[model samples]
Target: MPNSDMPQTRQHCYAYPHPAVTTDVVLFTIRQRTLSVLLIQRGTPPCQGMWALPGGFLEIDEDLETCAKRELYEETGIEGVYLEQLYTFGDPQRDPRERVISVTYFALSQSDNLSPKAASDAALADWFSMNELPQLAFDHAKIIQLARTRLLSKLGYSTIAFQMLPEYFTLSQLQSVYEILLDENLDKRNFRKGILARNIIKETGEYSRLGNHRPAKTYQVVNPSQVEIIK
Candidate 1:
């Protein structure tokens, strides 16, 4: 047997096997308790012209979160917000063209008065309610489900719901968002007590003057930096 110190005649270079790692962002916003996800129309083959989440290949030096935010802004003109890592998808055949792996991030944003501008390779970008989604390309549908589950779990104890609301809103409006996301009715008094008890919200001294009944007082999530869990 050759001495262990002897070098082998064969040469081997490190190669990145299969498809490269990529990143996908599931940007969600809530309007009237209806959850909406941002999607872009693809401009190339493999899923050309189909709707998909805003995402792209990661740069060699880019971190996962950095890639996600860059992709979000490049594809949908969205920026500067709370983004949480959700999951990674690495099915060998997930991408027809290559064995691409994707790290998915879920981003929350205020649903009111924010419109997306299509950029990058996206010909069009728009927010679609989870219920009314068109056929999504790739494993994006699955990614959305994963994000939804994480969001719901977080809502039980975290003030994550406010990420989808405006700076000032009525209690009913906030409650509606909770009901929609949780898919259940929350007792008004109980909800109020829980919310007030948390001390994470502040009265805005504003009211919704256009409602059928007397205008409800408006409030906003206080301590924007607080990440209180409801549970």
Candidate 2:
């Protein structure tokens, strides 16, 4: 029998011009009850000093997801959040340097406490609230809007919002997250009723103490790693 493990010969397929591939990450977090996203000021040419998403040209051997994670960490010193592939943008003129296609990933992170330092083609790293974004470079603003829309659409039918909360939180905190992303105030009773009926969280028997107010009962997501579909 022929050896199944035999190495196949490699050949360079240069017959057709191929565009370079890249992976960009849109890291979102809730800050002071506002929805925010991470941005990097480019330190290199082609958009130097302009704000953009953290990303780089994909190395030939690495998968798209791995490239996204690597680019994010290298530019912003952020990692560990589960990123969902948001979209593929292959417009002929998205990048000024060359013909490049971007596979973008987005994630909700409890990353307010983590400080991001700029490096590796990034001049500075910071979070900007969705309401007040600065001038962005290389079509990054459109990418962010698409990511935000995806998150909003998933909130009603999935447990995706839990990724933005801490391990234990009050129902108010959970409701605030939804309100901030949804951009509308939710009725406390109805929101609580709808959320509790889903059975995605359970009481930790803990209480969050606020200034001069009654302690609010704290709860935890039953399975933080999986986004259970509700409907």
Q: Which candidate wins on TM-score?
A: 2
Candidate 1 structure quality by residue, lDDT tens digits, 42-144: 9887899999999999998989999999998998888887899999999988899877999999998886546789998998999899899999999999999
Per residue, candidate 2 scores C-alpha lDDT tens digits across 1-231 of 868799878788787899999999999998877899999999988988899999999998999999999999999998888689999999999998889999999977886546788888898999999999999999899999999999999998999999998889899989989998999999999999999998999999979997888999999999988778886
Best by lDDT: 2
Stretches of candidate 1 above 4 Å error?
A: 1-12, 15-19, 205-208
The whole-model lDDT of each prediction reads 0.87, 0.91
Could you tell me how far off, in angstroms, the CA of residue 69 lies in candidate 1 after the best superposition?
A: 0.7
User: Candidate 2: misplaced stretches above 4 Å?
Assistant: 1-9
